[model samples]
Target: MRPISLLLILIGCLWSGGCQQTRLSFTQVETPKVPSFTAPTNAPTLAKKEFTPLAPPEVISLSDELSLHLLPGTPSKLVGIHLLAVSPDAPYENLDILHTALTQLSVKLANQRDLPCIEGLTIHPSIHGLRLSLKCPASALAQAVDILAQSWSSDAYGELELSRLKRQLALDKHIRAFNGSEIEEVWADKILGSAHPYNKALNNRELQQSLDKPQLLALLAQTKAQSQWHLLLEGVPQVDDSLREQLTASLSQLGAQQRQEERFVDTFSPYGKQLFVIDAPGTVQTQVRIGYHLPMGLADQEDSAFACEALSRWLGRSFSGRLYFDLREQRGLTYGIYGRCFNNPMARILKYYGATQQQHTGAFIRGILDHLKLAAEAPPSEAELAALKTSQFSQIALRQDDPGHRIEDYSQAIARQAGSDAMAARLKRWQTLTPEELQALAQAHFGQEPVIVIRGDLARIRPDLEEKLPEWQLKVTSVD
Candidate 1:
């Protein structure tokens, strides 16, 4: 009985020991500290430091107010001012009010005693607001900023002349309007297509009659108090902590005001094909523009963009571009030739333009189409590809030489919804593309039909040329 009891006790001890070993084994196995799977903790370190917000020159209670951006450079400075207000459902004619406001602003800026210190001043108006740009020697930026800030404040414009000037210039054509010559030709072309919201350009007559003081006051009364102004300072010197604080304090004084949102409508041709001709009689040569709609943004296919770049270089882009070689060099038919594909989120248009001898206009058009066909069919040779790559890379490098370019590039990339690394990635992708890939892209995009416009003496070439291009119906209009 005793021996049996001892055997039972030994078995019990062995079982208990085995259970203890199992627990120890699990403990030794260890939980992994997965370095690769760990969430990043250094994001704050990697993030760019935020700019200290600065006080604006002066605080204006008016809904529409000017905001300034001062970018300090090595030996000069750039100043940018944008007028902002809030008016949603404003009449199309109200643009005249804004136009007049801008003209008054420009005249004031141009006449300022401080103007002499500025190296250059450029006053232009866009859909958003009046743009006042001034550049001066780098050392002068601080002083300029001080002067501008003071002038923009409420006390700067005195009570005496506001009413008198408004009455005198109220009917003045030049004061209230933009010269037709000042308008970009492309904007005019778009205006010709549609007479709606897309037609934003102001002519002399509309500027004179559109907005009076009462309307302006009414619009201002409805303006939102918060700011819609965006201030961008690029290529500015890195300010020390003390100076940065001062800037912030000065800029913060510019009170907040909401900006008006401008709406744009897309314009399309009603007819399958339309031709408009402008007659510039004494011009030595004709200018031809061929436009086509394309996808608003880039394609997902990497090769598509590469192909476009290569085709552009080979055909009309580079110094030895095919158009120049064919039309200007070999045939001696034109003084210059070029093609451009202008792209935006809303539209993409391809245009081929050149100055050709009046006699060769028809031949020049034919030659351009023929070359485009050639690009579609043939792959670029290795030599041509190398040249294009070199040219593209060199151009990109040259663009970066300016500090302003870096800021602009970053801004545009943000606007386009592309990644910050887009420039570097595009270069890399272009480097990897093969000749076959580019050829395929050309075959896809370059073969489409284009809408053509010619500016020249229609009587000189019309009857004969119209017979040759039967597909293109021509309408000739005198410039006068």
Candidate 2:
């Protein structure tokens, strides 16, 4: 299959469905020569390096607007390129132009890098600018970066690249229609309210109308002039002096495009007092998505986020989370219940999603809210708190071993509204929280505003939902 085709399929599987359970195969294992098992050891004398937010050995400034963060020693020969473009401006208007320019840049970069993976360049565009990435051999690192520095370092967009982006966009639209829905939007709209600054969904018609050469060129210029840039290197800590010179030379003479001249924060808040129902008539089981803008505490204060994260993991992230124990392990309402928190400078929201029969939708949602309410009201029992901390600490240790995971974890903090210090603040922040403080923190944010969204057969589920929350207004929309 073509790389793009394979990538889309992989993404579809990851986003729309649950992971397949691992079935162990004893048949693949050979009997030991002694037919004996070694006893497990928790050696007191063994010293292990615990994980901390990785700090670069040095941050090399390439230009006033750019710097290279070197995460030195690595066992692999690949150079990881994490180019984060943070836009101080919000409500980044005309995302389509920004996206198209990026697609062109990726094509050019991949051609130069000879990306071994099926998916070469990854672009994650948010309300801000974007996080663009590529990984290549350490030997060709300079060449790869030269391609990048040369591409957007000036107003060099051409008619050919624009045509290529147009074709790909149309092709992508058609391909996606044959696939499943990108349901993150559904959850975001229901939880954060569509008016949230970060919730801006790019409109295709608007993009197509604005695809003139002058507009595309202007977009590229603005990106160069206004957007802020940073470099994060993993697998190799210190870069060669030659590479540093190249980066500095390029940065010093790069493009003049500037960021969008606006900043915004979404003031829209959802009242947990309301219940919303949208009818997707033909589906047998209802799909549920409940969310609220996560507490601002998650973004600004280390102590607040640490507490909220502990609560989040115990409540939804792990198999042992409360939602799994209550909704799946006990009532058998659905095969799974998933909850998570997403944060940016402009907004942060806690969202939970699950599916069940129409008759069971009301009870499940009510149960979830009650669970959230309780989680906020009091600290987890000693056992629950220990489990949450263990899971979190273990995951942190494991992440250090996986370069990809480390890159992604590091990425989240850099692109957020918070400056680069976000991750640094999170380190050991959990260790500082008292049990009482943790619960108090969760309570402070959880009690704010909550929005309940149910996509089900309203004719069958509405009455039950109504019975559960009597006075709440339920907004219904047509799925078709």
Candidate 3:
């Protein structure tokens, strides 16, 4: 009851002449005890289970120059045929043109055949070279393969209109000029030189003069003649014998060619110049990329591979990385940030990039550099290391269940020339990885000063950068 109400009742009792009999009472109760939690005196440590690696894909040589790698998938109605062609001679631009041509031809063939092939007939440029994928219903697998083979042999795009293509190029360039990440282009230019074939810029004038029906045909002919091809079939049990024979005949049409040895290009710049800026006059935020060219790929350094993976995860693995915690959570400098190992056929780049407000760009860069320094100084904690290893194992298990992801992973392995069992070997190595080993690797690799690329309004960011990182040399350039 409220105090006011109690007083009113007391006054009423006093007025009624019954105040002497009115008395207050009190009661006390004992408090209950919380149950004690006794720590186990002999808690058992988690026993490491021995990992059983997935069986490597079956490889069968279709011809002296061509091979088919098969990985059985769940008994499903769909199947995937991935054709990989690798050649240093094939420029990405030409490959892109061929991809467009082949895509159009595939659609035409599908329409003509009246095959309900609506899902997955695609081609794209990969780090290895050109990748063409045909995922169609298993019932139509042979027909789909025949369609693709026929399309490759056909001269469907021989009458392609050059003027129309040039107009499309102009529109594409216009769209990319405003929509694309300018920082990426600048980064490529800096890392792989402006004149490098990989860094070749596509301009309307150059494309107009060079790109046409004849050029496309010549490139296609060259690819068919010189490029080494690897075909992978992943789906269902037992690809029919007739289908195999058809594929073999189609591949045999192209003359036997030796696998071209990957030419090593000296891609990395010497570590001296540290900072570069590309000016974007009207931009409100800055794009920052900082990284170094690794000496070699993980596949080449088997002993240090797991350690490198651990280091990468420690530096940046989405939200779990230290870079995210320090730069975004602690300082509120940027909305997102990441560090990763970019594996190319010729170059292995360890890059960190993100975007931030113009004013915070300098601090953001500082935070990244500081984290790299910290990585060199100390290893990840036991908890962090444990989490990273768990994620690795979990990814392996999960990817194996999905046939699409499995095929992609297998193809990537083939592209890197990292054998079919690379992940299994990595698994074996990861079980024995230690914090001290990771620290050593980090000190060796992460201690170096990395090249930095910043793209934003230079006039706005320059002053803040000057104040924060004045010791670093700043090279400014106009956005291309």
Candidate with top lDDT is: 3
- RMSD values for the candidates in order, in angstroms, are 31.8, 11.7, 15.3
Question: lDDT tens string, model 1, 30-144?
Answer: 1111012223577453433322212222232222343333333422434332222222222223444444454454456557656565434443433323223455554554555
Task: Give candidate 3 misplaced runs (Cα > 4 Å).
Answer: 1-53, 74-76, 88-93, 159-164, 195-197, 201-205, 208-210, 239-241, 258-262, 271-273, 297-299, 303-308, 478-480
lDDT of 3: 0.67
User: What is the Cα-based TM-score of model 3?
Assistant: 0.82
| lDDT comparing candidate 1 with the true structure | 0.50
The backbone clash count of each candidate, in order, is 14, 15, 0
lDDT of 3 by residue, 1-480 (tens): 699999999999888978663231211111211112233689876667645667888888878777788777555556777777665433444454565566665566556566776346777566456667777777776666656555556365654555655565566556767874667778877766666566652332464547767676776776666566787777745656787897887766555654456654565655464689988887878898987766653455655445446666667776757777667766677888887776555556677888988767777887777777766777666776776677667667788777767777776676567866677778877777777777787888776677888888787677778766778888986445
**Which one wins by TM-score: 1 or 3?**
3
Which predicted model would earn the best TM-score?
3
Give me candidate 2's TM-score against the actual structure. 0.78
